[model samples]
Target: MWWYTFAHVVYHLIRWFPKNNRLKIRIVIVLFSFGLLFPQLFVLSREHSTRYCGQHLFDFLIVSIVFTFFMIGFSFIFSLMDPVPWEVKLAFHIFGVIAFVMGLTLTVFASLAVDCRNNTLELYYLSVSAAVLTVTSFAFLMVMIPFWLLNYFFPNSVLNRKERTGVCYEPTACCSCLWHI
Candidate 1:
């Protein structure tokens, strides 16, 4: 459920990113500031939190901030590909979710491994699962790569009936719904 919401928010943010100069500048400034202070903040948080629960809370806070920064960077980078279709952007967002999940699983496994040394086999299994997810995420990208290549290599194969008027008269089923909205 949260994934759906986050994806929706990211999609809209990407949609707006190319149009908003002020947002672009602000995002760049925020990213720069966070990059400078993140290491210090993370080290300080780790030193101050003695309790396991408090340490976990700090970890969560830091992870969330880093994830936000990552999303902004992701959107900014994708927005730079101005000629790309919206469907491709959506695909990239889905790819990002898969990658994020893989990363999260690995982080959990790493964090728990030290405390649960007796469960060495279980941690190995978790590591294997994360590896599987990593493969699956890239597999998704591999599937999309051919289509992107086709689009790039044969741009004229895709029809744009009303290029000047910014209208697609013969929209495909996938794009028709988006066009109406």
Candidate 2:
């Protein structure tokens, strides 16, 4: 879980270069990682199942919502950086929104499964839920790890640094031209 969180932070920092679109991508990555960590939290709530499965569900929902908001907030902050094509940004947002919603739904169901009594029926449900969440989480991680590695080893190829002021443009196009006038 800590490794997942650390990877998210590193991904965000890397996205700060070149275009801001990377930030939105990173946000999705973070949310996906959060989805992966969510099932483990149910283990914590398992100790309190006698209180009612609804209680565990509520806790899961609240945490998922809070984390979703954080992910979106970070994406908003990234938007304030270098301008990026709206389509690219929109693509990221759409994927993120869907992923977040699915994650929350799966987590709630998983929590409910865990909160249920340990019997053959409940075990079957828990196993199925666990299998689905694990498979989905692993698929996301598989994609994310390769993407991160590609960017890390060849930063220049995958990332673009901000252009230095007065460097790329011709001298005649500089503010110095107006000063002379």
Candidate 3:
């Protein structure tokens, strides 16, 4: 169901682009690059000297999500501009970085600082959750991109043989079965 929602949103988001495939591809590449950055940060955080720092994988995931949100927001803002002014783009870029840092700090404080630290299992749980969710999101994007491009280039090309004659499944159906849960 959440996958359905994600696909629905992404479908609309792809369509929301200005019909220039080059620009669309560029935006998708940028977003995917940002997506790839999280795991490197996760690796770095794991090597931190402080135990508490690496102990909270869920907190790190939260920070990553917050940063991704800010990135997407900034991308949307940039997409709205026709001929983007250098100063305006620079200003938004600085604001996005500041906002992401603020969000990361708040999430860390909320998830780690306020919680009681006696149990070791919670640490394990956070780490496991972060790993699982990170992998899931990464795989989801991997699956989504091909389907998105298929839908973009050759829309509604797949047929649903079990259904009525000539009925077709949308390209999103490619990964919908795997992620429907």
Best by TM-score: 2
For residues 1-181, write the lDDT of model 2, one tens digit per residue: 2222333344355444566346566566557656644654554345443345532443544454455455545445443444446775575556555555556565556655653444333333543554365456656666566645666676533333244333223443544332110
- lDDT against the true structure, per candidate, is 0.46, 0.47, 0.46
Clashing residue pairs in candidate 3 are: none
Q: Write the per-residue lDDT of candidate 3 for residues 1-181, one digit (tens) a residue.
A: 1112232344345444475554765467457646645553554455331355444544554555555555555455454454658886576547544644544454444355333244334444444444444345445556666655665666444343355222234433554342211
* Winner by lDDT between candidate 3 and candidate 2: 2
Of candidates 2 and 1, the better by TM-score: 2
What tens-digit string does per-residue lDDT give for candidate 1 at 97-142?
7546745654564555454333333333333443344455456556
- Lowest summed lDDT across 10 adjacent residues in model 3 is found at 1-10
TM-score per candidate, in order?
A: 0.33, 0.34, 0.31
Q: After superposition, which runs of candidate 1 have C-alpha atoms over 4 Å from their true positions?
A: 1-13, 16-72, 76-132, 159-171, 174-181
